[model samples]
Target: MGFWIYMLAMDLLIPLIMTGFGWYFSGRAPRKINPVFGYRTAMSMKNQDTWEFAHRHSGRIWKICGLVLLPVTVVPMLFVIGGDEGTVGTVGGIVCGVQLAVLIGSIFPTERALRKNFDKEGNRRKDGQG
Candidate 1:
């Protein structure tokens, strides 16, 4: 039971949050590619090959992780929560928090670095015109 909430958070809610995040970031008012602004690294690739390649690669990884984590973690949690027969507020809360921390901290920084490197250009000085 304790582990189940963590599973649900990591496998389900986090991904859903990420999806909403993508929408919010992509659907900006000006609709510009501001990687640093949202940590969303929307690479404006005119080349179809490069675009398709990136989609195939990074998209595939995200998909696979979702596929694996969903059933292995989330579904069981749904069952556990539905069952609801024990003290699920204490240990579960702590574990769930740790799971969230690990997931967010691990992926956010790593992806931030990746986007900064592969998608976004380096920061130009304010005194520009070079």
Candidate 2:
């Protein structure tokens, strides 16, 4: 029971935090060099424009994915709280898997956006690229 509760809390809390971070940092991410925060991907860090664009794009993705995931985490909790350890573990694993999927899924769109908006040299595409 206690373990289930912890698992549920973690599933809910992690996505909530991610959502908050995405929302807050999307608009407020720094343009300068920083070790932490913001979307720090190879394509995104190509330049300031790419960096900012990726962060903003990823932020929206993360926010949406996190929001969608939050309610989902609760469903497993309801089942786990009443079910046996096996069920709890299965539910917890599923929740984690979903969360991982969401995180990984969010990156694809952001990377695609980066590729669309920027050229191979990381410069903004002005003509037909966008």
- For this target, which candidate reaches the highest lDDT against the unseen true structure? 2
CA lDDT of 52 in candidate 2? Answer: 82
User: Where does candidate 1 have its weakest 10-residue lDDT segment?
Assistant: 26-35
Model 2 per-residue lDDT tens digits across residues 6-84: 7888788769977997897677667674557677778888888888888788888878888888888997688658678
Clashes of each: 0, 0
**What local lDDT score does residue 126 receive in model 2, on the 0 to 100 scale?**
86
Identify the runs in model 2 with alpha carbons over 4 angstroms from their true place. 128-130
- Quality of model 1 by C-alpha lDDT: 0.43
Write the residue-wise lDDT of candidate 1 on 46-88 in tens digits: 2332233333334434444434444544444554574453534
Off by over 4 Å in 1: 1-11, 19-31, 35-61, 78-86, 90-95, 105-130
lDDT of 2: 0.81
